[model samples]
Target chain A: MVRLRLHLVAGIVLAFAVRGPAFAADFTVPPVPTHYVTDNAGALSSATQTSVDAELKAYEKATGHQVIVWIGDTTGAVPLETWTGDTAHQWHVGRRGKDDGAILFLFMHDHKVRIEVGYGLEGSLTDADSSRIIRDDIVPRMKANDPNGAVSSGVAAMLTTITPSYAGVTPPPAAENVAPPIVSGAVISMFGLFGVFMLFIAFVIVMRIIGSIRYGYLVMRKGAPAAKKEMKGFAFWDSSGGGSSSSGGSDFSSSSDDDFSSGGGDFGGGGASGSW
Target chain B: MQQRSWIGPVAVIGIVVVIALFVGSAYNSLVTLGQAVDAQWGQVENVYQRRADLIPNLVATVKGAANFESSTYEAVAKARASVGQISPAVVQNAVNNPQDFAKYAAAQDQLGSALSRLLAVVENYPQLKATENFQTLQAQLEGTENRIAFERRKYNDVAQAFNTRRDTIPTVFFAGLFGSKFNEKPYFKAQAGAEQAPAVNFSP
Candidate 1:
C-alpha cells in the first residue's frame, strides 16, 4: 500500500511538471484577422462587420491609427487584461515607432470587453476614456444582447476620443519614449554564447601553443624528454542548454494593398477591462 | 624537427588571430545583451513611476467620499510614501543589486495591495463609484496596475536573457574576464499573496 502511494505521488509530481507548457500551448495567439474585425463567436452581423471594417480602414488611413475588433468565444482561463495585451502586442496593431494602435477585445462567452491602447495613444485615449466607453457604450449593449451595437459605438467612442484635432494628440514626428519591440532579442544572445564558445576554443589553442614552445625548449636543453604528450581538451558544455528559445517569427504574408496589416506597434498595457 | 621550425611561428600567429577575433566578438555581444537589460530596466521604472504619479490624485479623489473609511486610503498613502522612500540611487542600480531589487519590488507590491484594498473598499460606496472623477481614477489605477505587470514581465525576460548568456558554459568562463561588467540581473519574482484576493473586512 505504501509502495502504491509512493507511485501515485511520483505520478502527480510528473503531471505537474508537464502542465506548465501544456497550459501555454492551449491558448495559441492567433494572427490579426482580416478587414480589422474577426467575429469568431458570430456576435456581429455581416452588415455591421463590413461597415465597421470600412470605418476602421478609413480611420487608419486618415490618422495613422490602427483599431481592430476581435470577438472570440472566450479568453479561457487567462485574465481579460492579460489576454488583450498579449494579443494586441502579437498583432502589432499600430505604427512602428508611434505605437498609435488600439484593439477592442470582446470575449462573448466570458462576458468581458477590453480596449487595449498602445503606448502612443495612451495620452489621448486614456484608461478613463476606455473604461467609460466600456461602461456606457459597450457593456450596456452587450448586456442587452446586441454585440453589434456594442462594438460599433465602442469603437466610435474610441476613434472620437483619439481623433487628433478633438483630443489634441498630434502624432509626434518622432517618439523618443517608445522603444520598438525587440525582435530576435533571444537569438542575438544565442550568438553571444556561440562567440564565447569560440573564445574558449581559442584559449585551448593558446595553451597548446604555450605547451609546444615549452616542450621545444625542454628538448633543446635536455636533449629529448618522454614522447608521451598528454593533450587534454576541455569540453565545456552548457547545462542550461536551449533555455533561451527565440520568439518565433510572426508570419506577415497577407500584404495585399487593401488588407489590414499590423504596422509593428508596441503596447504597455494602457487599457481597461469590463464584464457585463 | 628542422623542417617544423616554421610551423611554431605560424601556429602562434594563427592562434593570436583567432583569440583576437573571439575576444572582440564575445565582448561586443556581452555589451549588447547588457544594454538590452539596462534599457528594459528603464521601461520597468517608467511604468512604476507612472503608477506612483497616479496615487496622489487617486487619494485626493477618494478623500471626497463623505464618511469614507480613512484607514484604507491612509494605508494606500503610506504605501505610496514607502515606495517613494526607496533611494533613486538604489533604484537606478537595482539590476545589479539583488537585495535592493527585492526591497524595491516588495515596496511596490505593498503599494499595489494597498491600492487594491482601497478599490475594494470603494465598492461599499455606490455614490463614490458613480461619480465621474472617482470612476476615472479607478480606471487609471487599473490600467497602471496592468502596465506594471506588463513591464515587470518584460524586464524579467531581458534579465533572464542576460543571466543565461552570462552564466552558461563557455560564456560563464569568459564572463569573469570583464570584472563586474556582466553582473547577473535579478528577476522580479511573482508577487507574494497575489493569488489570494485582498480580504475586505466589513464592520457592522
Candidate 2:
C-alpha cells in the first residue's frame, strides 16, 4: 500500500511537469517579424507594402499604437481565431499596459482574413467595424483580384477608425465583451519556481522523517502524551504532499531601435474573421 | 562551555527564521495566484454576459424573417432563460466549487448550441441574411464567440498555474495552513464535438 501511494505521488508529479509543454507543442506560431508588414504570401504589391508600413510606423510614433499586416499561406488545421489570438499575444504587438495593437492577417491559400484587435484597441475598432472593413474593403477587392487595394484600403479604414482619439468608432457598446489585458510575465516566472519546488519537496521529506523520529523518541520517553500536538502538525504536512514543480522559461525581452518589435500588446480575441 | 551553549540556541533560532521567511514567501505567492484566479473568473463571466446580452437583438432580428422557424428561435430564448436562471452567487463562487462551475458551463454551452442552431437555420433565409443590421449582428456574434473561447482558455491557463502552485509540496503546506482560502480551481473540459464551431459560410 505504501509503495502504491508513493507511485501515485510520483505519477501526479510527472503529470504536472509534463502539462506545460503539451500545450505549447500543438500549434507553432511563427516568430514576430522585424518589419511592420510581413508579406509571406506575397499577396500585397511592394508599393502597397511600403506605404502601409510607413503609415503604420508613423501612426505608432504619433499614438503609441502598433498595427501590422501579415499575409500567410495557411494556419493548418488550427482554427483562425485561436491562431490569430495566440500570434497577436506571442508577438506582443502593442505597447505594454496599453495593449493598443491590431493585426490584419490574410491567409492566401485558405482564403481567410481576420482583423485581430488588441484589448485596448477593441473599444476604438469594434468587431462590427472590423467586419465591415473586411466586407466592404477587403472582400470585394479580393474578389476583384486587387489584393493591394484590399490591404491598403482596409488598413486606411482601421487607422481612420482608431485615429484622433478613436473618433468615428460606433455601436454594439462591446465594452462588456472586451477581454482584460493578460499577464504573460506571470507564466514566465512560474516556470522558474519548478526547480525551487523540487528542493522544497526533498526538504519536506527529510523534515518528515526527522519529525517522526523525534515523535517516536518522545513517545518512548513520555508514553506519547506531550508530543501529540507536534505529531498532529507533522500529519498536516504529510497530507499536503503530492504534485510536482514547474520548469522551462523563455526570455521575452523586447529590443529597441530600428528593428521592428512588438510593444507587448495583448489581444482578447476581440476582432472579426471573414473569408471570400 | 558557556559560549558553546549560546551556539546551539543561536543556530536553532537562525534556522527558525529562515524557515519562517520561506513559509511567509510561499503564503504570499499563493495569495497572489488565488487573486489572479478570481480575476480571471470575472473575465469569463464578463464575456459570457456579453453573449447573453446579444441574444435579445439576435432573436428579434430572426423573428422578423418571413416563414422563419419558430422552434429554432424559441430554443435560443429558452436556453438564454436557463442561463439567466443560474444565480449570481453561484457564478461568483464557481472557481472554488467544481459542481457550480460545471453547472454554469453547461448552461452556457446549451445557449451556445442553441445559438449555433439558430444561425444554421438562418441559411435558408437569404433575404434576412442580406440585411445590413443582421450582418452586423452576425459579426458581433462571431466576435463574441471568439472572445468567449479566448477568455476561457486564459482562465484555464491561470487556474492551471494556481492549481500547480497550490499542489506543489512546500506551497501545499502553506495552502493547507490557509484552510479553504485556496481551493484548487476547476478547469473547463472541452465538450465533445462542441469544441469546434459550426461552419457558417458567409460567402455569396
Candidate 3:
C-alpha cells in the first residue's frame, strides 16, 4: 500500500512536469496581410480578385477604412461572426484605435456570410444595413452559385453605405516584416540560467556544510560572532556577478526604436453576423 | 561516522529550505492572482458604472419624445434599480462566490437586455435617433457594452488561471501538503438568449 501511494505520487509529478501545451496550435487562422483579399477557399478567380482588390485599395486610399474579405470552407462550430471577431483581434484589422476595419467573411462550404463591422464603422453601417445587404445583395448571388458576384456586388453595396473619413496624407509605404516571436531565444537560454542558478545554490549548500563543520567548534566556543568575517568575505566575492548582470540589464535594449509591433487597434465585438 | 552524523541536520535543513521556496512561490502566485481578480473586478465595475451613469440621460432623452412606450421606460428603470440594488459586498466577493456573481451578472444582464429593448424602441422614433444628444449617447452605450464584454472576458481568463492553478493535481497536492487554502473561482457566463442573433424581423 505504501509503495502504491509512493508510485502514484511520483506519477502525478511526472505528469505535471511533462504536461504538453494547453491548447492546440491550430494554424487555421493565418497571419494578417498588408493588402486586402485573402481567398483561401479559391472562391474568387483572377478577374474577381482584380475587381475586389481595386475596390478595397480605392476604399483604403480614399478613406483609411480597411475592408478585407475572407473566403473559407467553414467557420467551425461557433457562429460565423464570433470566429471573425476573434480573428479580427489577432489580425489587428482596421486603423489602430479608430477600429475602422471591416471583414466580409464567406464560408463557402458552410453557406454562411457574415459582415463584421468594427466599432468605428458601426455608426455608419448599422446592423439593419448589414442584414439588408446580406438579404438583398449577397444571398441572392450566393444562392445562384455565383460567389464572385456575391462578393463583388456585396462590396459595392457596402461601399455605398460606408461614410468616408479622412485617412490624412498617405505618404508612408506599408512596412512588411515577418519577425520571429519575441521570446524565441529566452526559452533556450533559460536552461543555461537555471543550470547556473542551481549550481550556485548547490555551492551555497556545500559551503554551509563545510562552514558548519569547520566553524561549529569555533561557534560554540566563541558563541556565533566569529564566523561573521568569513561570511562577509563569501558574500562580497559572490555579489559582483549579480551586480554585473543587473547593471548590463539597466541599459535599454539595443534595438529600442522598433521593439514592439502593433497598430494600436482595439475590438469591442460590435458586428453583425448571418448565415445563408 | 562523522559524515553520517551531519546527514540528519543537513537533510532537515535542505528539506526545510526547499519547502520554503516552493511554498513561498506558491503563496506569492496566489497573492498575485488574488490581486488580479481585484484589479479585473474594478475594471468590470468601472464599465458597468459608466453604463449606469448614462441611464438617466438616456431616460430623459427618451422621455422628451411623445407617445414612447411607458412600459419600455419602466423596464429600463427597474433593470437599472436592480443593478443598483445588489450589495457591494456581494459584488466584491463575486470572484469566490459564484452564486453572488450569478446574481450580480443576472442583474447587469437584465439591465443590458432592457437597454437593448429600449434602444430598439428608440429606433421607432426617427427624430429621436437623429438628435445629437441621443445619437452620442447611443454611440457611448454601444462602446460601453463592448468594453463590459472585453473586461468580463479578461476577468474570466484571469479567474481560469487561478482556478487551474488551484484545482490541477500537482498544485492541488502541494497546496494540500502545505495546507494552502487556494480554491477554484467562477467564470462570468453570457446571459441567456445572448447567444442568439437579435431578431432580424425589422425590415430595413
Candidate 4:
C-alpha cells in the first residue's frame, strides 16, 4: 500500500510537470507582418508629392510600422492610368517629371482592400476629395466585405469627377503617340489680331502727320498777307494790354515753367510743349 | 503495544496525506491563476486590435475634413504607421523588457494624441461630423476604449492574485524554486493632460 501510494503521487507530479511548460508556452495571436503601404498613387505634382511623403513618414513614425509607398505614374509593368482598368499590371512607376504621371497607393498588409488615388489629378481632384469619396462610399462597403463593389464604385466616381478637367486634352492616342496639345492655331490668331491693331494705329498716325505738314504749307502760301496783317493787329492790342499785367504775367509764366520742369521726368515732358 | 502500532501507522498516513493535499492545492491554484492571466491578456489584445482597426477610417475621416492642416494630418498618419509597425514579437518582448514596454506605451500615447487632435479638428467640419461612417467609427472607438479599460482591470486583478501568491510566505518558497515569480507589467495609465474625449467638443 505504501509503494502504491508513492507511485500515484509521483505519477500525478510527472503529469503536471509535463503539462506546465506547454501551457505556459501557448500565447494568443501569432506574430504577423505589420508592414503596410500607406499611400500609392499615380504621378503627383511636386507640392502634393511632398505632402504625401511627409504624411507617410509621419505615419510610419507614429505607428511604428513600415509604410511602403509607390509614388509615380506606373505600377509595375503597366501605366497607372491603365492599371486602374485592369489588375494584371505590375510596373511600379517613380516620379519623373511634368510629363510623367503618378499615383498614390495605400495598402495595409492585413487589410484586404488597398486605397489607390491619382495624385496627378490634384487641382482637379484633391487627396482630400478622393479620400473623402473612398471613406464615404467605398470604405464602408469594403469593410462590409464587398471589395469588388467598393473598388468599382470608387473608380467610377473618380473618373467621373476628373474627366471634366481634361476636356480638350485628349487621351494617349497610341503606344508611341503621347504628345501634349498643340494649340498653335489659337496662339497664331491671338498674335495676328494684336499685330493688325498695331499696324492700323501706325497708319493713322502717319496720315495725320502728312495732313498737318500739307495744311502748314497751304497756310504759308495762301494766307501769308492776311496772317501778317492779323499778327500786327494782335501785337498792337497785346502791347496796350501788357502795361498793367506785365508783373503778374511774368510770375505766372515762371511758376508754370517751374511746375513743368519738376513734373517733366516722364509724363509732363511728353505733354508740356506739345499741348502748347 | 497493539494500540501504539496502529497509532504510528495512522499518524504517518495522515502526515503524508496532509503534505500531498497542501502541495496539490498550491500547484493547482497557481496553474488556474496563470490560465486566467493568459485569458485576460487575450482580452487586452483584442481590444487593442479593435482600436487599431478603427484607425484608418478615423484617419480618412479627419483627412477629409482638414486636408490643408498637414501637420495635424501628419501626426495622425505617423501614429497610425507606428501602430502598424509594432510587430507581435516586439509586443511579446514588451512583457519582459521595460524599455520595449515604454516604446509600446509611447506609441500608444502618440496614437491617442493624434486621435485627440483629429477629433478637435473635426469640430471645424460640420459635414464630416454628420457622416454616417465617421459617426459609426467614432462610436466603435468609444466602445473599444471602454472595453479596453474593463479588460485591463481584469488583467490587473489576475496579475495581482498571481503576484500575491508568489510573494506570500510558504508559496513564495515554491515560486522561488520554480522561478515562476510574477513580472511587473505597466498599465495604460492616462496621460496628465488627457481629459474628456475630444469628440465631445464637436458642437454640431
Candidate 5:
C-alpha cells in the first residue's frame, strides 16, 4: 500500500513538473506580422496590380504558399464577400494626402507588410531600386509565373534598403521583447491544495468518531471486565454518587489536590492522548 | 495527512503574469510610436531633397526668359544662395542654435517671394508662356511646390504624434531617455496677401 501511495504521489508530481514549464512557455512573444500594403494609388496603377497578381500566383506555385492581394481606398474598407479563394487577403493601398502614400501587404503566414512613403521618396529611391523590385524581382517572376521567387527577392530588397538610421527608426525585431504573460497554474494549484487540506481535516474527524463508536460496541459484546469497569464509572458519574463523594470534606480535599496535580502534569508531562 | 494546497500560489502567479503582460504591452507600444516618428521624418527629408533638386532647373528656365527683369533674377539668385547655405547639419543643431531655424525660415520665405516675383515677371512675357519647355518646367515647379507642402504637413503630423506620445502620462517617463524633447521647428506660415497656387495662363 505504501509503495502504491508513493507511486501515485510521484506520478502527480511528474505531471505538475511537466505542466509547469509548458504553461510558462505558452506566454512567449507572438511573432510580428511582416506582410502589409501601403496607401499610394500612384504606386499601384492597373499595370502594377497585374504585376502584383502575377507575382502572387507565381509565389503560390513555387512555395505552395498562397499569396493574396486586395486593393482598397485610402481608408481600409473592402467588401468581405469578394475575399474569396483559398489564399487571398485584403489590404489598403491609396494616397492619404498629396505626399502621403501607404502600402499594406499580407503574407500567407499571417505576417503583415506596411510601407508608407511620402512624396519625398520619389526622388530619394532611385528609379533603379524601384524598378528592380517591381521589374526584376516582382514583374518578371510574375510574368514567368514564379511568385515564390518574386516575393523572396522583393522582401530581401526591401530589407536591404530599409536602414536602421532612416528617420532614426528601428524595425520591430530590434525592439526589446515584451514581458511574458503571467501564469495561472500557481494560483490554481494553491486553491486545489487548500481545498484538499479542508477535506482531509474533516475526514480525519469523521473517522475518529466512527472508530470510537465501534470500539464501544466491541467491548460490550465481549463482556470484558474492563468494559464493566468503564460502565460503572459512567454510571456513578451520571447518578451523582461520585460527585457527592468528591464534594465531601476529606474526599473533596483529595480531589482538589488531584485536580491541581493533573493540571500541572499537562504542562511538563510526556504522556499524550491518541485519537485513532 | 492533509494534501498540500496549491491554489494560493497559483492565484499569486496568475496576478503577477497579468501585470507583466500589461506592462510589457505598454512599453512595446511606446517603442513602436518612437520608430514611427523616425519613419515619418525620412519622408520629410525625401520631399526636401526633391524640392532642392528642382530649384536649379526652375531657376535656369526662369533666368532664360526674365533677362529684362534683373531685380527678380537677383532675388531668385539670393534666395537660392541662402537655401544652399542652410544645410541639414545646421537644422539638426536647432536646439543649440535656435537662430539657425530663423535663418532657415527667412531663406525659404525669401525663396517663396522670389518665385512669386518670377511668376509675376512671366505674366508680362507672352512669348515665354508659349514655349513648350518653359511650360513643362512651370508645371513641374508647380507639382514640386505641392509636393513640398504635402511633405511639410506629413512631417508635422509625425512630429505631433511623437510629441504627443512623449508628453502623455506613463510614456513620458521614458521619453527623455530616447532624446525625444519638444522641438520647436519653424512652420511654413502663409505670406500676407499671397494667393493660393495662382492660375498661370500658359496659353498665348
Candidate 6:
C-alpha cells in the first residue's frame, strides 16, 4: 500500500511537470491581422472597431504609411514596449524599405498604451510626441476605464500631428514667416524694398513733425519739452520694421505635404509605453 | 650498433617536430577562439549587469511619485535578486555546462520580464512618467535592453565559431586532454514567448 501511494504521488507530479512546458509553449504574442485594427483583448467595441477600422483603412489607402491599433490583455506577460515593438516589427506595417510602421498598442488588462514608432517615423512620431499623446489623450480615458475612448482620442491626437508629409518636421523659410509671396528671391527682395520704403515714409513724417515743432518753439510757440515727448513716441517705431512680420506667425498652421508609408520601413525598437 | 647513419634518425626527428608544431598551432588557435567566446559572454553579462544596476535607480525613482501597484515593484526586486545569484565562477563555466547556462539565462529572462512589467505598470502613472529622473532611467533601461540584445547576438556568433573549432577533427580529440575549457558554449536563446519572430509586412 505504501509503495502504491508513493507511485501515485510521483505520477501526478510527473504529469504536472510534463504539462508545464506544454502550457508555456502555448502562450504566444497574438498574430497580426490583415486589417490595421486588431482587437484581440475585446477591449474595443465592435462599433468602435468598425469606425476605427474604416478610418485606418482609408488613411492607409490614401497614404502608404501604416498606423495600427492593437488592444491586447496585459501585453501577454511581457514588457509592453518590447512586446509592442516586436509586434510592430513583425507586422511591418509601413512601406517595406522605409520601415515607417507604427503600432498604437493598448494592453487592456494592464491599462497600458504604447506607440511603437518605426525607423522612418521616429522623426515625426517622436518619443516626446508619443509620451505627450499618451499622457494627455490616452491616460485619462484609460483612467476612466474606457479603453476605446483612450484609443480613439489617442489616434486622433496622433493624426493631428501627422503632416501627411514625412515623419520629421522641417523648418519653413524665414521669408514665409515674413510674408506669403516670398518663395522666390525676387519676391523676397521686393518685400525688403517695400519694408525699406515704409521705413523711409515714417522717417520723413518724423522729420516733418520735428521741423514744425522746432519752428513753433523758435518762431510760433514754445512747447519744446512737449514736442520732445512726441519725439520719444516716434522712437518706438524704430524697432518695428524687423519685428512685426516675424512675430505675427501668419503661416503658423502650415504643415508639410509629406505622407508616411511603410515604404518597406523597419523598426530599430523605438517607442514609449505607459500604464494608466 | 654505432652505424653512422644519422640521416634516418634526423629525418624522423624533424618530421615529428613539424607535426607537433602543426598541432600546437591548431590548439593555440582553438584556445584563442575559446577566449574570444568567453570575452563575448563577458560583454553579454556586462550589459545585463548594467541593466540590473539601473533597476534600483528606476524603482527608487518610480517609488517617489507613482502610486503604482506594489506587486510590480516586488516582482522586479525578486527577479533582480535571482539574476544576481549567478556567480563569476558559474559564468566562467557556463559555456561548458548547459545546465548552468540555462539557469543563468532563465534568471536574466525573468529579470527582463519583470522590468518590462514594471515599465508597463509605470505607464498608468502619468505623473511618474513625466518626471525627468524617471524618463532618464527609462531611457537607460531601454538602451541597456537593446545592448543586451545586440551583445547576445554577438556572443552567439563567437560561441558558434568557438564550438565549431572545438568540434574540428583533432581539436575534438585533444580538447579534453588540454583541459582548456574549449567546449561548446550555449547561445542566448530567450525561452518561449520572446522566441516568436514578431509579425511584419516588409515592402521591398
Best by DockQ: 2
TM-score on alpha carbons, each prediction: 0.75, 0.77, 0.55, 0.38, 0.38, 0.42
The model with the greater DockQ, 1 or 3, is: 1
Best to worst by lDDT, what's the order? 2, 1, 3, 6, 4, 5
| lDDT, candidate 4, B1-204, per-residue tens | 767878988999999999889877887777777677667676666667777887777767667674546687678778878877888887754644557767877887688777667667666777777877776566555444444444454455565565555445444445434442344334445464432222121222
Model 4 lDDT per residue over A1-276, tens place: 574454455444533443321211222211111112222333234554444344433432332111223322223432222222122011112111211122224222323222332223333443344445555555676466554344445544544454443222233223332335556677768879778789789977776665555446656977766654544444211333233221111122333211110101110000000000
Model 6: per-residue lDDT, tens digit, B50-136?
Answer: 778888887788777646688888899999998787888997678878899999988989988887788877768877876767765
Q: Write the per-residue lDDT of candidate 5 for residues A6-69, one digit (tens) a residue.
A: 5455444533432321211222221211223221322344555445445433332332222233
iRMSD, model 5, in Å: 38.9
Tens-digit lDDT string for candidate 5 (B42-98): 554554566567667766776787465777767877787878887788765542244
Q: Give the alpha carbon lDDT tens digit for every residue of B1-204 in model 3.
A: 777998999999999999889878876787688778778788888779988998998999899999889899789999999888888887877776778888898899899999899999887998887776775666557546755765676676676666556545445545444432454566677656443334332222
Q: Write the per-residue lDDT of candidate 3 for residues A1-276, one digit (tens) a residue.
A: 574466456545534542221111222665664346778899889889876876676666566567878787886775454466566666666666677777788888887777777768877876557766776788888888888899988887787788433232332333232324766566758768777689789988876776566566666666678665554455423432222211111222223332212243545455554456
- For each candidate in the order shown, give its overall lDDT on alpha carbons: 0.75, 0.80, 0.67, 0.45, 0.42, 0.65
Alpha-carbon RMSD of each model = 15.4, 15.8, 15.1, 39.8, 32.1, 26.7
True contacts kept of each: 0.34, 0.40, 0.05, 0.00, 0.00, 0.00
- Name the runs in model 2 displaced over 4 angstroms: A1-25, A164-259, B193-200
Q: Write the per-residue lDDT of candidate 2 for residues A81-191, one digit (tens) a residue.
A: 778887887788887678888999999999888999999998889999999999889998888888899998899899888874532223223343344556566664876
Comparing 2 and 4 on TM-score, the stronger one = 2
**Which sections of candidate 5 miss by over 4 Å?**
A1-276, B1-31, B92-102, B177-196, B202-204
Off by over 4 Å in 3: A1-35, A40-67, A73-77, A89-266, A271-276, B32-43, B85-93, B97-99, B116-154, B173-183, B196-203
Task: Return the lDDT, model 4, position B166.
Answer: 45
* Predicted chain B of candidate 2, TM-score versus the true chain B: 0.93
Chain A TM-score compared with the true chain A, each model in order: 0.60, 0.63, 0.55, 0.26, 0.22, 0.53
Model 5: how far residue A132 lies from native, Å = 28
